[model samples]
Every structure is written in structure tokens, then in C-alpha cells.
Target: MEFFYFLLIGAISGWLAGQLWKGSGFGLIGNIVAGIIGGIFGGWLASKLGIGGGGLLWQIVIAAGGAWILLFIISLFKK
Candidate 1:
């Protein structure tokens, strides 16, 4: 189903972002949430910028980028 795919993508993206960003990522649940939200943000941003997001790989890349951005913002607020 599409929902399952979304979740899968989100989980992978979140995990990857956490690893790349060198942050805790708020654990599995938080990572999932962040990734899902990141996916939406990335998709929207890409659309708004008139850029093609490509396929799954590109989706993951965008999602990870968005997730890292979210984490950075959160960290800034936490500090």
C-alpha cells in the first residue's frame, strides 16, 4: 500500500539523516515522525522550487535533508 511505502521511506530517511547529522534523532519513534514530516516538507519544497525529486533515492535524499534541517532547528531551540 502507499501508506506502507511512505512509512518505509520515512523510517529509512530518518535513520539515514540521524546517522549523517551525528545526532540522536529522538530515537525510533521520533525519527519516524521526523522522516514523515520531512518527506512532506521536502516534497513541497521541491515542488515550490520547480525541481524534480526523481525516484525513491531522490525522495530519500530530500527526506534526509529535510529531517536534518528539522533536527538542526530543534537543536537551536533546545539550546
Candidate 2:
């Protein structure tokens, strides 16, 4: 289902973001939340920025990129 894909992409995006940033993850639930939020932001930003990519993989990539941005901000606050 579409919803399942959204969650899946979001989870993977969060995981990938965690991996991108060292010591930046709140665990599964945190990741999901971050990922979902990032996915929406990323998708919108990508469209606005005219970044071109296709398919589920592209979606995950963009979402993860956005997640990384958010996680970085959170890390800044935590420090």
C-alpha cells in the first residue's frame, strides 16, 4: 500500500540519516518521526529545487538527505 511505502521510506530515511551523522539517533521511534518529517520536507524541497530523480530509491535518497539535515540541527541543539 501507499502508506506502507511512505513508512518504509521514512524508516529507511531515518536509518540512513543516523548513519550519515555520527551519534545522532533517538532509536526506532525517533527515527521514524524524523524520517516522516524529513520526507515531507525533502520531497517539497526537492521539487522546489528542481532536483531530478525517479522511483522509490530516489524518494528515499531525498528523504534521507532531509533527515540528515534535521538530525544535524538537532545535534547542534543537543551540544
Candidate 3:
């Protein structure tokens, strides 16, 4: 269903972000959480900035961007 698809996207997005940023992964579950949260942040950012992407692929792109930013912030704090 749509809900499940969103969760899948979140997991993938988080995993991708973690891979992109070395040593920022928090395992599978944590990644999922971060991605889901990041998705929201990304969507909001896109909306505020008047940017948009259509379809599922676009959603993943937006989420990945957000997840990466989130991980980057987390890494800064961890340091």
C-alpha cells in the first residue's frame, strides 16, 4: 500500500544518506527513523523554496537530500 511504500522509501533514503556520509549510519531501524524524519524536513524545504519533484523517484530524491542534511547535522554534533 501507499503507507508501506513511504516506509520503504524512507529506509532506502536513509540507507543511501548513510552510505553517502561515512560513519553516520545508525543501523537499519535508526536509518529508517532518520529517513522518515528527513523526508518531512526535505518536503518542507522543497515547499518553502518553491521546488518540486513529481512521482516516486522524485520523492526519494527529496528524502535523500533531507536525510543527508540530517546526518550531516548529527555528525557535527557527535564531533
Candidate 4:
């Protein structure tokens, strides 16, 4: 279903962001939360940047990028 696909994307995005960020990986639930939120942020950012009509792959890329940014901000506050 579409919902499952969304969740799958979020999980993948979160996991990918975590791996790429290094020492900033949140656990499963956290990853899901971050990914979902990041997806929203990414979508907003993409729209603001005039990037639209992206497919699933583009969505994942944007989501991962957003997740990475989110983690980076959190890391800053933690320091």
C-alpha cells in the first residue's frame, strides 16, 4: 500500500542518513521519527527551491538529506 511504501522510504532514508552522518545514528524508532519529520522538511525545502515533481528515488534522496541536516542540528545542540 502507499502508506507502507512511505514508511519504507522513511526507514531507508533514516538508516541511510545515520550511516552517512557517522556517530549520529538514532535507534529504529528515532530513525523513523527523524525520517518522517525530515521528509516533511525536505519536501518543503524542495518546494522552496523550486524542485518539484520528484519520483520515489528523488523523494528518498531529499528525505535523507533532510534527515542528515536534522541530525547535524541536533548534534550541534548536544555539544
Candidate 5:
């Protein structure tokens, strides 16, 4: 299903973002949440900026970028 693919991409993106961002993700659930939200943000950003996010790899890349940014913003507020 489309939802499953989205979740899969989100999980991978979140995990990768957490790993790259010094492991700040809450846990599996947190990562999933972050990734899913990040995917939305990324898709929105891509659309607004006229960037292509058509393929699975592109979606992952965009989601990861968005997740990293989201983590960075959260850390800033938490500190």
C-alpha cells in the first residue's frame, strides 16, 4: 500500500537523520513520527521551491533533509 511505502521511507529517513544529528530521536516511535512529519515538511518545501521529489530516492532525500532540519530546530528550542 501507499501508506506502507510512505512509512518505510519515513522510518529510513528518520533513522538516518537521527544518526546524523547526534542521536536525538526519542526512539522508534519518535523516529517514525519525526520522519512522517519531516516527509510532509519536505514535500511541502519541495513543492514551494519547485524542486523535484517524484521518486522514492528523492522522497527519502527530501525527508532526510527535512528531518535533520526539524531535529536541529527542536534541539535549539530544547536547549
Candidate 6:
């Protein structure tokens, strides 16, 4: 189903973002949650930046970028 595919990509994006930004992952459920929310944030941000596209690869890139931004913000508040 489309929903399942979305979740799958979200999870992968989150995990990838975590690994790239922090050298670790937030576990399965955490990754899924972060990915989905990040995907939403990423899409909004991309639209604002005049970036638009389709396909699984683009989705992952956007989601991961969003997740990285989210993580960076969180780290800032943690300090």
C-alpha cells in the first residue's frame, strides 16, 4: 500500500539522517516517527525554497534533510 511505502521511506530517511548527523540511529519506532514528521517539515521547507519534485529518491533526500535540521535544532536546545 502507499501508506506502507511512506512509512518505509520515512524510517529509512530518519535512520539515514541520524547516522549522518550523529553517527547513530534512534531505533525503529523513533526513526519512523522522526522520519514522518521530518518529511512533512521537509516538504514545507522545499516548497518555500522553490524546490519541487517526485519519486522515492527525492522523498528520501527531503526527509533526511529535514530530519537533520530537526536534530540540529534539538541539539542546540540541549546545550
Better model by TM-score: candidate 3 vs candidate 4: 3
Off-target runs (Cα >4 Å) in candidate 4 are none
Q: In TM-score terms, which candidate is top?
A: 1
Q: How do the residues 26-70 of candidate 6 rate in per-residue lDDT, one tens digit apiece?
A: 666776677888888998999999897898899899999888888
Q: How many residue pairs clash in each candidate?
A: 0, 0, 0, 0, 0, 0
**Model 6 weakest lDDT span, ten residues long:** 24-33
Alpha-carbon RMSD, candidate 2: 1.4
Model 6 TM-score relative to the real fold? 0.86
What would the TM-score be for candidate 1 when compared with the true structure?
0.89
Question: What is candidate 4's lDDT per residue for 1-79, written digit by digit as tens?
Answer: 9888888888889888888878557777787778878888888898999987668899999998888888888889978
- lDDT string, candidate 3, 1-79, tens digits: 9789888889889888877777557777777888998998999999999898888888998998999899888878988
User: How big is the positional error of residue 23 in model 5, measured in Å on the Cα after superposition?
Assistant: 4.2
Off by over 4 Å in 3: none
- The C-alpha TM-scores of every prediction are 0.89, 0.88, 0.88, 0.86, 0.88, 0.86
Q: Candidate 1 or 4, higher TM-score?
A: 1
Better of 2 and 4 by lDDT: 2
Candidate 6: give the clashing pairs.
none
Global CA lDDT computed for model 4 = 0.83
Cα deviation of 75 in candidate 4 (Å)?
A: 0.8
Question: Which consecutive 10 residues in model 4 have the weakest lDDT in total?
Answer: 23-32
Write model 5 residue lDDT over 1-79, tens digit each, in one string. Answer: 9999989999999988888887666677777778888988988898899997578888999998888888888879989
Worst lDDT 10-window in candidate 3: 19-28
Better of 2 and 3 by lDDT: 2
Model 1 C-alpha lDDT versus the unseen true structure: 0.83
